[model samples]
Target: MNQTVVSYLAQYEFFDSLLALFGGNQGLLTFVIFMIFCLAIVGMCATIGGLGTYAERKISADIQARIGPNRVGPYGILQFLADGVKMMTKEDVMPFSADKFLFYLAPMLALVGVFATLAVLPFSTGFTLSDMNVGIFYLIAISSLVGVSVFLGGYASNSKWSMLGGMRGASQIISYEIPVTISILAITLLAGGMGFGTISAHQRGLPTNWFIFHNPFSFIAFFVYFVGALAETNRAPFDLPEAESELVSGYHTEYTGMRFGFFALAEYIEVFVVCGVGAALFLGGSNLPVDLSFDIIPLQLVEVVIFMTKALLLYYVVIWIRWTFPRLRVDQLMSICWKYLTPIAIFNLVGCAIWVVLFNGKSVAQLLMGGGH
Candidate 1:
């Protein structure tokens, strides 16, 4: 197995040498490092969620032909900070009829499920937190937990609207996962592995080499995956769970203060996670179109920036979509997932497999162009 970034750094004597200066035991040092990494992930996710809110609002305002946050701090960059403080200082109210335990448990569960999938995210060639062999499979399994959390949050709220919203969320997410998995499987077949790193490494640096443009089937599969992902994240068009016009804030209806914030944060963070995975699988993740060998800055950092840029572009699309599209009814959401996306995804998967067998892993673009580039 290839060494992960952390393991690579440790064995190269960087971590050991640094820790030795602190006179810490190996186990202590390991634990401390692990904790720091965990903190970093949490901090990163929370920070993204914070800034993402501002970005989304600004984007929405721009789409509607209005100026966005310009008061909080130059161009309202600090608006999210003010929003965070407001949410923090707000009352943490709970409905008397709510199931206290489950109510409290829901947000944590939602956050945990979303964050846990970060393990398999290959930020760059060697920068993943955990590069498991079953990386994609693990991601599918863990992400399903978000549905359960949504359901619990709604059910525990003891409100009719909340319960209905939770039910919709659970059904929507669970149904969507089917297409998402099959769509990803299309890429897995082409890559011949499930690891995020492996899949990314299979692609070349050029846009033509990206999986979305690899073949007809893969191209179709990318749309299928993208649709499934939007539903999975409870984004617009598929956002019946929190359809304010109907459900009055959905599953987290009764939640207040940080509890409500957790749900919101988890939702936004999941948006990035899905976008990251999409970039890794379909875009030439972290791969520059042309190589630049710079001695001062590592290639890994460059790759990370490239990968994030792709993901961020996708993330911007998600926000754009939320503001542009109207929410689909529950029936429409189900029909699209079960009748359209799932079958298309399955066919795409099978078609991709056949393409791989016939083309011997060469992309259509590569095969047509006589490939030596």
Candidate 2:
């Protein structure tokens, strides 16, 4: 059975007391628990997204040798909050020629697509909202909504710049997704399953056990996936979709107030989600360095902390890369994805499969230690 947060909670004795408090309506109790968790996860991600903007500015400032936002609240920690309030209070302006329905729906789609992926993100063994057997596939499929939203937003605006930006975004995202998906498929092959839970489980115990270190091909696959993910999420040097120099903010040129805020927030949160997926897939996820014979709530929380640390470290890298690299030209972007990344990703996938067959699915570390499968 696919374990979920509620199911994991049900294994505890206190859950029985809560069941009685809810008059033994297990269905109702499950619904309430799921709702609470959903709220908590969404709230946490939203906060992370808001803080991402602050991080971006601060990191950029440090890179450029300047002081960033420091006036708001104690080293400008609350700058994101101030920005949020500003966005909320700003006048919402839509182009007179815009398609009313799509202009409104685009941001909603972006937010929904991003938030939906959180359901299967393996924060820990027991904390995932849903540990679906098709978790990885679900995330890949659902997150495409952001690309659709980008196109719709650009088209709905009735501006040449927006239309061009949207087209670039759609094509860039679609092209890059090929290598990303294939790279992930390689990990799925090594894990023998597409579920995030299964993938993470295969990599538990130590850093050497991580899929990235499973083989040379898997290690290469990690970089392939990272590059593809950066493009997919519109991060620099793959941020051609919203290049301010040429497209004047691109797909969101005409968007203002909270509508534009939604797009920004979606992009930031999607970065976090992508980084978390990378950490879970390539790092050891929430797994500790040492194996534990028993699981407890405290240990689970510790695992959550470990998982966050990995994800956030990757987050910092994403920000660092954005500030470090110059944006790629559209041709260079497409060339990298199709000419370079796709071919390399395909090679890695085939190599991983061959390695699995030749070595009886033993990771390099396992084989070195004379461990048998």
Candidate 3:
């Protein structure tokens, strides 16, 4: 599997031809190419964000035994377009009492943070925008910007409920990140690297080979990561920051029209990004259930479909959870993170290290089936 995928990427003739134009200035050429890739990713994220809202509404409607959206296009597929038009046409209102600069800057900052994580994602073999060595660490760092933006959005709003929501969101995201980072490190320890492509590349060619089944500790880490990610992204059961019952509209209470749309877009994009990260780290990312030699279509196309299917499955689950679970109280949310999830995540990280040493890097499935390849 490695030889097939890695070899193709290494000898990518198109990329090689592009590199030839740079001659001695390969670094600049790489930077230029990366920027172009980032632009594409931004567009992709925005499109996904719009589609995600439609999916959310439809799924929630089904769960609640309703029709969801059926007005615009077939089965309301064009509802997102209608929503976008509404947002753009609606009044762009800013309270006279609010700080104009921070109010405007907050949504942009949040949007940047979530979308930037896409840069390091390995969409498929040889299809990463920029596979940085410290990719996982880079994702953690960039995502913290969400907290900053939330806080600024709240404080700049000049509304007490907005301020409280912002503060809570900041605290919740920062606290959950501790467990999130540790859980990710558990996978990194197993993969023996921080690059996402490197980590995903280590997954073997079967469902049993996925890291989620690597060991009991890695298994626990998967759930821990899932829970922490829910909190980090302000999903239900941990959505205290935007608790409509208590905080009006939460951090973006004073925002309207396009500014509010930005916040919504960022939130939805973060949902997919977190789920995608979960897929890459725990599932056999972009790997098929059975290894198939590419004959008709390119291997990268097949791999991308597999990867997105896994990611979107998780994304669907997130939506399901949102409609099923009730939001937790702020105190309960904090207690869950600090008193339970963080400690358990730490233990899983340690246990994974010990398991790796004892098993000599073999996954549980490998041990159960026979010995390592």
Clashes of each: 0, 0, 0
Where model 1 places Cα greater than 4 Å from the true spot, the runs are: 11-16, 19-26, 291-297, 371-373
Tens digit of lDDT per residue, candidate 1, span 1-373? 6445566457555676877876957667766666776677678767888889999999999999999999998999999899889989999999998999999999999999999998778887666777778998999899888999999999999999999999999989989999999999999999888887788777856798999999999999988999999999999978999999999999988899989989999999999999999999998887778755542227777878898899899999999999999889788888999999999999998899888888888898888798643
Report the poorest 10 consecutive residues by lDDT, candidate 1.
290-299
Better candidate by TM-score, 1 or 3: 1
- Model 2 error, position 270 (Å): 0.1
lDDT tens digits by residue: candidate 2, 253-308: 99999999999999999999999999999998889899889889999889889999
Candidate 2 residue pairs that clash: none
Q: Global lDDT of each model?
A: 0.87, 0.94, 0.87
The lDDT leader among the candidates is 2
- Highest TM-score: give the candidate number: 2
Q: Which ten residues in a row have the lowest lDDT in candidate 2?
A: 364-373
Instruction: Please report how far candidate 3 places residue 28 from its true position, in Å.
Output: 7.8
- Runs in model 2 with CA error above 4 Å? 371-373
**Which stretches of model 3 miss by more than 4 angstroms?**
1-10, 14-36, 290-297, 371-373
* Candidate 3 residue lDDT tens string, 1-373: 3222223444656657666787847676667766665777688778889999999999999999999999999999999999999999999898989999999999999998998888777777566776778888899999999999999999999999999999999999999999999999999999999988788778848788899988999999999999999999998978899999998889988889989999999999999899889999999887767666653337667878888898899999999999999989878898999999999999999899999889888888788778554
RMSD of each: 2.2, 1.0, 3.2
